[model samples]
Target: MARQRFGLEGPSHTGHDVGHWDGLKAGELRIQRCGACAEWIWVAQPLCPSCHAFDPGWEAVEPDGVVYAWTRTWRAFHPSAEVPYTTVLVELPQAGNKRVLGLYTGADDPVIGSRVRGEFESAPDENSWPLIRWSAV
Candidate 1:
């Protein structure tokens, strides 16, 4: 069972929490990277799709990026998800134009290619996990 130690209870590994805190703790926007081909890949992969290399690793990345794509969800995808949240696809120029998907805060509509920075929001008082919110920079 997931512990409620943090007010915002989240998955530790199976879902969203996969590499979540591990990334934050390292001060990195840790996305799956292919060591052999040196390509940043998303949606989680054990192998590199480009070079077919099994030598995958996590690397630190800058929080800065441009909005490659985005959407405003009026309906809740998760019960814990706050409605009217803006989800963004951030294009990391430093990482081969690979996009990092995250929730955008402080706005309803976000433009494609808009500058944005990652914000690590505290995961409520009792929660020990690292939660992040993004916004226009």
Candidate 2:
């Protein structure tokens, strides 16, 4: 998640998170998996917390997931964000139930354990990156 993608400026780049970022740029949702134990890792990690292995590999995952949790807030969390937004923690079954966070844009109210699908929207220009928006399945 580059800060520039959200109209901010700072060191949003991460050596470990690059794979996830690159996947977003390619319009795919990527998750890191521990090569040794095959356990899914989120937020990126140089070493697998599961097996104490080095350099988990990244792979594209089925983007659909179930809503594990959610929150609605009036405050804009990021630059150029509209007031009053919902953020969801989605758990991908195929990705070992590893949850990923994204903005919820579904018309219906967010409910716990509701099924949702990830939608990728390309950035307006090269200066920005794509975002993974969530909606009810």
Candidate 3:
């Protein structure tokens, strides 16, 4: 499942999250880092809440990670998503241990601390956008 599965359509890529979407389009995982304190910032922010640095820089990080947490959705959180899809919060070791959420795809359910890797999946429909999905390694 992609972000569009929830009708999120990902980001507009015109504002704070531009670097993130651009990186995704380029098949890279880029996270914002504080220029001053080197704090990793996910969900994009204009300034570092940790050090109050203005405008963080985008840096590519390894897509390899591990499942920090996971849940199998049995409820229809959104109409576009089929029931019983797995969603996971993956912690990137190369990215200051920042955890990011994504749809999980694999032969088996994800377990906590399971090794995983992220990959970009092309949009399935006009309303969707390319998004990263995680799979067990």
Candidate 4:
């Protein structure tokens, strides 16, 4: 398989919670949840930040959400990343208002509380990691 290429070289993904990326590669949105307290966790953690439980596991979640916050970047932090891209904090109502951050691909300006849905973009290489982009719904 060709190495996955998402255009931009992402930051280091090495860590315990990196399994979330595997879910993306499989076209699923997975998030960590506290097995004990059942609280949703973001940015993936080995232990639940809320209940202090260990061995948190992943669960598939609905892709639909509302934009809680957003911002557009004019500067290219990396040469491969295009400027003027919008990043959004999406609140997943199904997941106890837990929020996930991703790039917004819609043409219109992002509005707080706007409905959005996740769209997984596959890497140029079949084996490369996939990404989740959001679109206005």
lDDT (10s digit) by residue, model 1, range 17-128: 3554578755567777788888777766657888988747777777889988988777756665556666788998887787777777765478887899987755454446
Which residue runs does candidate 2 get wrong by more than 4 Å?
1-5, 8-13, 77-79
Rank order (by TM-score, best first): 3, 2, 4, 1
- How accurate locally is residue 118 in candidate 4, as Cα lDDT from 0 to 100? 91
Selected candidate, larger lDDT, 3 vs 4: 3
Cα lDDT tens digits, model 3, 48-131, are: 989998889999997899999998888886767777788899998888899888888864779998799888887678666678
| Candidate number achieving the greatest lDDT relative to the actual structure | 3
Question: Regarding lDDT, does 1 or 3 come out ahead?
Answer: 3
Alpha-carbon TM-score of each model against the true structure: 0.74, 0.85, 0.85, 0.84
Per-candidate Cα lDDT values, in order, are 0.69, 0.80, 0.83, 0.78
For candidate 2, report its TM-score. 0.85
Off by over 4 Å in 3: 1-4, 12-14, 125-127
lDDT of 1: 0.69
Model 4 clash pairs are 4-128
Residue 121 lDDT (model 3): 80
lDDT of 1 at 65: 91
Q: Whose lDDT is higher: candidate 1's or candidate 2's?
A: 2
Q: Summarize candidate 2's per-residue lDDT along 1-137 as a digit string, tens digits.
A: 22223454212556787788788888888899988898899868889998999999988997899999998767767767775677799999999898988888854578888899988877777776678888887
